[model samples]
Target chain A: MTASMQSSVGNPADEKLGMNLTLRIWRQKDPSVKGKMVTYKVTDISPDMSFLEMLDVLNEQLIMQGDDPVAFDHDCREGICGMCGLMINGQAHGPQQTTTCQLHMRSFKDGDSIDIEPWRASPFPVIKDLAVDRRAFDRIIQAGGYISVPTGTAPEAHATPVPKADADAAFDAATCIGCGACVAACPNASSMLFTAAKVTHLGLLPQGQPERDDRVVNMVAQQDREGFGGCTNIGECSAACPKGISMETISRLNHDLLGALRAGARPKS
Target chain B: MKKAVMAVSGIVMVLYLIAHMIGNLKVYTGRDSFNHYSEWIRTIGAPALPEQTALTIIRVVLLAAVVAHFWAAVSLWRQARRARPERYVTKKAVAQSYASRTMRWGGVIVLLFIVYHILDLTMGVVNPEGHDASPYDRLVASFSNPFITAFYVISLLLLGMHLRHGIWSATQTLGQSNRRRERTVNAFAIVFSTILIAGFLIVPFSVLFGLVD
Candidate 1:
């Protein structure tokens, strides 16, 4: 087993191999409370521990010291869940392309001091610390991010006859985990990449065609209504995306929107 | 739809800049050629259409494009501001260029310069020297003033920066960019903007230095 596993169980033997690090975490009692970065020094942290696990140790220390632990969000410890997100060192999802849970302590040196904060967009207000309301994304999706069909049929998967290219592109677009990292990393806090990912994913498939026109128009309108900034195509969204969703999806979204406009289709209010 | 309008109008402006640059270079060909070219612009549709008819048509189309472009820009700027009401306490800008970062300010400077340009040259209201002279003489008189020359140089530089970002962004907005072609598109934007700026600047500099007099 790794040193992290041993240290988790309170084994003294692996203590010598751990590293000391400092964390500057944001702390806010609630949305109305003024937040500040509270620094804490963590000793004997295992290099193999995930970033969240390191936070867990810090929380334990804070609890033992009769202090309020820093609040954060996490569900699946794995990267796919999209529940965990942090602006580690001013980057969305830390310095790595992976999510917070997947970021290991080894990415940092023993003497490193890390800064952690929540997503800072207006649409996403911080609830406490490191957790913002990303429901604006949900609202955008609900606007028209899905394909509509009659329920209750397990159709044969091969019947659709999707081209390999389109299937692959759709899958790539579908990889968006609804994380707000794209918004957090963007200078304008634009959610075009995230919105485009949803639009392109469904727009690429045969099942997505019927709703395609309305889908782009409605979803884009919803995105704007949510107060997410217009995309300048600066390309930070793709860079900050944990799944590496391409900016091409945004281009595709624009293409679809133009086509919809040319066809005289207006988004449903 | 706003982005589409911005991209289309922006491209139209870029094309106009290129054609205008090429036309201005004729100043080096002597007063007869330069004045002839300037007169030709107004007489393009003569006989079939009235004098200055073609130029009026061009001006109207360009005015409509400029209005659309400016409106879209302002709306997008306001929308972006609303997107993030609370700014980040500590922020890091990744994957953004200096040109991209300064686009708004650069656009403002370019807009101001366009107004100054129209006043000084087209209307002859702001020209330091004689306003009743021929087109070629007015061009010479304006650039001979150091302050006017400096203003033109500064404005052209800002315009070049704006174009550098504008061209690449227009392509992306129009869905012309991809992973492989991104670098090519960026390089093309740089080269194209540089050449356009240089072509335009040469006229004012030549007049300032007495090369074209």
Candidate 2:
């Protein structure tokens, strides 16, 4: 058996190596309630605990004391779901590329006082503490992101023989998990990153060719309609992206949008 | 004529700067060459269109371009504004470079400075107080003012930034999107803006520092 396993098996004292920590969490009854950071002290935190798991431990203690449990959103715990998001010390998703769930306590030191709060943006209204309604992203996607692929027909994956380069680019775009980190990380709360990813995803594929022009047109229009900011090509979105989505996608998005504008001007000649 | 209008105007502005730089290069040849060069251009109307009508037409065309460039910029800005109502806010300056972030403000300041420039030099209106001399002498005296020299420096810096974006953007606007050409244009934009800023600043500073006198 390994040393840790063997120690736990051999002596009970070995299991007592835990850290004491404090958390200042945002406590809001609802979106309407003015929230404040309420401090909670916890002892005996497992060094191996994921940050979310640590929160779970504190919530378990609160419930036993008949106090209202702190509410936060999380799922998948693998960083793929993108459900977990929080600003730990002013960073989107708290000092990590992906999400809150994947962040472990070990990334922090013992006795560290962590400040956790919800993503602050006007459009992303807080549903409950730490869980803003990200449906603006859904609406952006619904506005014409998909190819008009007919239902109930699974094509042979290899039938189209997509050029390797285009396919890879499309796959890179497809990795966007609809996390609002880009929007949160942006100074202007710009949705350019998310919208561009969706547009580029469709724009890169041959199957997406039929409605490519229309897709760029409507999606860009929708993104603007949804109150996102114009991209100044500052490159913050790509830098904060967990998947490292390139700012080149935004460049491509700009080209496509500009092309769409030209097409609008040209008429059915 | 819309695309051609922008293209022709943009190229004219670019060529004017090149010719302006060559004229300004006369500073290296001392006050005599510099003033004589200015006098020669005014007399012979170098780079201006056919004969005496050339100077008048050049002025008209230059003014038209100023209007067109500003009009296009305003229209595009309005469209972009209507497109996204919310602005960005950040505790830190994010991934944006200083030049990229300051474009709008820089453009506006330079625009205001251009007005001052026209009034001072072109129209001979709103002349600075206590600086009466020949146009050339006025130019020298104005450059002698630390305040005037400072404004010239600051505005020229902003002008450099504005041109860095404007030159590259105008190229993209013209649909020269080839990768090689885009990179070339981008580099050219940087060099062109830098040279223009340097050329313009040198004259004022030279006169200020007694090099011209």
Candidate 2 clash pair list: A187-B89, A188-B88
Worst 10 residues of 2 chain A by lDDT: A260-269
Compose the digit string of candidate 2's lDDT tens values, residues B71-151: 655654564455333332223344665666676678678779989876776555655533344456557667778887898
Please list the residue runs of candidate 2 whose C-alpha ends up more than 4 Å from where it truly belongs after superposition.
A1-22, A42-47, A265-269, B1-23, B29-94, B104-108, B124-135, B161-193
By TM-score, the best candidate is 1
lDDT of candidate 2 at residue A81, scale 0 to 100: 86
Would you list the C-alpha lDDT of every candidate in the order shown? 0.88, 0.71
Distance from true position, residue A139, model 1, in Å? 1.5
Per-residue C-alpha lDDT of model 1 across residues A1-269, encoded as one tens digit per residue: 87777676786646544688888888899999898888889988887899999999999999999998888999998899888999998899888888999999988888788999999888898998777888999999999998889889899998889999989999999999998999999988899999999998999999999989999989989988888888988888898899999988987888888888789878888
What lDDT score is found at residue B75 in candidate 2? Answer: 51
- Candidate 2, what DockQ? 0.20
Q: What share of the true interface contacts does each candidate keep?
A: 0.66, 0.12
In model 1, which regions exceed 4 Å deviation? A1-18, A150-154
- Per-residue accuracy of model 2 over A1-269 as CA lDDT, tens digit each: 89999999898755755778888888878977777888999888876778899999999999999999988888898989878787776667766666778777767766878888776666577787667788887877787788776798788887888889888888898899887878777655778788888988888899888877777767766766666655555566776787878766766666776677777622121
